[model samples]
Target chain A: MDRSNAMPTVLHAPISPADIAPFKIGDVVYISGVLYTARDKAHDRMLADPHLPFSLQDACIYHSGPLIVKEGDTYRVVSAGPTTSARMNAQTPSIVKQGVTAIIGKGGMSQEVARSFAGRCMYLAFTGGCGMLAREKIVEVLDVYYAELGATEAVWKLKVLNFGPLLVAIDSRGDSIYETVRARSHERLLRLIAERKRAL
Target chain B: MPSHREAFILHVAQALQEAETRLPRDVTRALANAAKVESNDRAKEQICTILENVKLAGAAGLPMCQDTGVPIFFVEIGREANIDFGLKEALATAVQRATDAVPLRKHAVYPLTRRSCDEPLFDMICDVSEGNRLSVAVLVKGAGSENVSALAMLEPLQDVRPFVLNTIWESGGKPCPPIIVGLGIGSTFDGCARLAKRTLLRSLEEDQSPFEAEILEQINELGIGPMGLGGDTTALRVFVEEAPCHTAMLPVAVAVQCWADRKARFSIKL
Candidate 1:
């Protein structure tokens, strides 16, 4: 809950562990630099392949399935928004183990995934459905990998500029905003249900 | 000039683009109000970004969100229109054209094989109306909210409140709250699910009944807030559409819609 700094932290990708160390849950961040898009299928493929075409060292993984179209010679990103991240929960820790230091997505991730960030990772929450905003930040579509996975599921290498207003929802210490919200909300739900039972 | 059937197909494509790019007026107003009331900095920021995204999408004529979603069409055909064309086939063609024209994400895939489908992704529900006007509306539904939607066949005495609350709780930020909840009560299993999904098309500008308001209040009370980071605006509205069912059955379905609330409509007088 330390949102003391009014300014958003500017992060450059290939984000290092040290770069993410100062930020905590509830802080805001903006990313500028290289990131890769990896959804459910891409995650499976990335982990299964022994030799990935791209390196994962200090890489920033974006849980997105961008709407990209080919324009004769090159690809154009139409609308690139974060997909639900919880679905990637299982594959995430393994990806983190491969030296991923930053993950940008919506809907947050699992507690297990939070625990996976214990020492060298952070999860940034982008507003869901903000595809146009995301598109604005993406300066270039560097390349595409795994085109066979379909445009939505393929791994896209992108270069972005100040790509955020992302909330630091999970810190390296394993504290998570989603976990805290869920706990508080559960208590309220129980109270409301109890009142309902009594009324009945 | 294109044939009447061709014209109708083009209309559907235009409707798809309208639905994908612009947040409906009712939805935009609701989100604006929600933004004003949001006390938490995180929640406020999320709402503001959504508003900004909507503006940008509309201005640039881009799909508001990347997940343009499976296009669900609600077609109201006038009986006197004497429809000569294959409505379903025409709708399919429109979707295919829009896939490239509006640049919708090719979201449909084969269920088992998980490969891309040649046909554009869409669902259609048709209704017969009195006049000679064919009205078509589209709701672009994203997976995040649609996945969390639940249907429960509760006992006759079972209350609907708990099921609704529990669904929202389990959903957490996954559906991208502040969500719009559509509740279908007292119909057959599949019918109730349809009832719930259809309710999502209703404009938020419409008034809510006390029951709908109460459920809405209770849901927001869960404090799941925007993106479930926690706050007062878990859901902007709750719409309930109920149908009488057998005495032994109390089927309820919850259809969750994300904040985008993207929808558009077009009417043709034949």
Candidate 2:
């Protein structure tokens, strides 16, 4: 494990799937390296064919289909905000086990995925709709892996800066912010309804 | 005819861009009032900050919100109007330009591959009504609140209160607090969904139907509050739009618009 840059509050990792397994809840992580973008269709394809197009070992997967503009030889990311993570719930565990280090997306993931990948990979929630801000951190768009997927769904290798202001929602210990919030909200809602009924 | 087409397209585009640039007047006022009425200090402060940010963004010509949203256009075209240009194409072109010009965030996703690293702006839906005068309403829906939207078809005899309340409860803090609930009732499943989307475009300050007004009061009484932190103002407003439906089914669709509630409308004659 690389401890040279790890701080008590946040850890700096060359971030790979292997490195993600040991992270605990509330651990702030600054991922500064390459990550790939994929959303619905890409997930479907990867699922249909057990053989992934590229090696995902120790890599972070971002649930985003960024706006890009092509230059002479490279592509520039205009906005690369994270999409809702819940949409990818079914495919998460499978992708996580494929050696994904961390998952970056908005909203929350499904309970099954959270439980299955608990202690194996961490899920980080990014602020939704901050595409331009997210793009600012990208140093370069390394390469486009799947052109057929079009710009939004293609897997593009992105090199990032202090790339994230991510919240540690799901830790290696199986803790999930989504689950906690949902349970609490449900209880509060029932109480509110009950009170209203009593008053009626 | 061409002139009318040009006028319609240009006016609609300009209206949408201007709305995108400026904060909705009612929203600005409501947030201020909400801040004053809110008892929770933290939620009050949050509302104040959000209002301030909106003002600053508008003044500086920055996006009102980070999520400019997928540009959804609801157009009512007059049957007698002789428009030479293709309305859909014109709107699409305007959107593409706005995506770059207003520098609106591109929120459109390609259905397959989900690889939208480029060409971010895409049309989500467009509804056209034939008429003599064209009325276009543009609503820019952000992903945060949209992610929490829900729809359910109830038995004709079943009460809808439970379904609506449960959906709102499930939404929690994800949609951002103090949301506007757009309820579409009485249509087919898909029609109701579209009605729900269209309802968000209605002005918050306008007087609603009597039944809807009563429902709105009840919904706000839910106490979901700002950011779901718990307070008196769970929902800012509720708009219900209905269409005639079969007696056997009751389709209900709920679309939640966050505090941002970005929308604008314009009309043109050809």
Candidate 3:
């Protein structure tokens, strides 16, 4: 836990199984290189469409709805930050199976999602709602897919640099920080209610 | 003529951008206080990150959150307002202008078809007021919190506190704590939702009712902390708005709001 000695890991895409293996639950990471943006709608589309324009192998997917502007013919990222990943739970396990090595989002996923890690995938959460911070880390947006799915839910191929302080909420071995906190909080909630008796 | 339409459009656009990028004074103060009180290291770290993010977003002139949320307008129109132009059209135009100006994510989708809306997009709620002045408040609420907001019709004798607690517990980290829980007790089921949603517009500096204060204390004690990581700041504030209900029903609505809590308001005289 010594901050001065332990430098954070900086990951670049296409991230390999080996590149992410050293990360565990609670290790903070910074990601650079090629990352993809896909939320609920894009997830569904990618799962259904066999002819996905981009490959999913070793891909790092970010759940984001970037505020982007079109300047002449190019797109500029104005704000890029993570969205809640819990909503994508149903599709996440399958997406991981498709060889996604890392998933970046805010809020953690479920037990089922943790199970999908299978010692080969990890879930990284950035500062929720910190779009400006995230956007600054994004160096360029390479290409966009499914542009029709509205801005938030579309697929964005982005080139990033040091895209973190990403806390590893779920690690490759199927361990989850969320579940740990949930159990602890639930116990506290009960004790607090019992002490107060909800009398007021 | 003060060019009401044009001025109002500009006002709305500015408000939208401000709401998207900035946390209101009361919200920031609440967060600062929360950080001071949080004992859990992880929870404190999360709160600090949020505060730091706010500063970074402001410096960069970018949205504080990537979701940018669904832009919702609460419009209060005066009784003697002379409306030579269409208010709805003007508001819509304002939304488009803000969309391009703020560069808000075009996330609107047709409910049934899931197809996207092409132009400046946002939702609005209109209410009539007594004066000749027009006031509009804009709130940028992200889906993370919206997805957890719920309405329930409980038995007349059932206590509302249990249901509210359960909602927060079940939501866990999904709504992006530390969040504000806006409770609407009494009124019809749908009306309760409206009440709860409206309560979010109130400033955190407003006087807290006794019930609200008690709930706030207990919610923090739940130790959901910031981002549900376990701490004493699970919720920064609890706001309750109530209305009369029928003789045999107890309706409750919980509107979960994320820490972003971005809001901006404008009042203009016609």
Two-chain DockQ for each candidate model: 0.92, 0.14, 0.69
Candidate 3 matches the true fold with a TM-score of 0.94
Pairs with backbone N, CA or C atoms under 3 Å apart (clashes), candidate 1: none
Candidate 3 wrong stretches, greater than 4 Å: A1-4, A190-200, B1-3
Chain A of candidate 1: what's the TM-score? Answer: 0.96
Query: lDDT per residue, candidate 1, A118-171, as tens digits?
Result: 789999999999999999999999999999999999999999999988899999
The per-prediction tally of clashing pairs is 0, 26, 1
Worst 10 residues of 1 chain B by lDDT: B1-10
Order of the predicted models by TM-score, top scorer first: 1, 3, 2
- What lDDT, from 0 to 1, does candidate 1 have? 0.92
**Stretches of model 2 off by over 4 angstroms after superposition:** A1-13, A16-30, A45-55, A191-200, B15-70, B77-86, B96-133, B141-157, B170-179, B187-195, B205-236, B242-251, B258-260
Which ten contiguous residues of candidate 3 chain B have the minimum total lDDT? Answer: B221-230
Candidate 1 lDDT tens digits, B73-174: 999999998677899999999999988897989878999999988787789998998999999989889999999999999999998899999999999999
What C-alpha lDDT do the candidate models reach, one value each?
0.92, 0.71, 0.85
Task: Please state what fraction of the native interface contacts candidate 3 reproduces.
Answer: 0.75
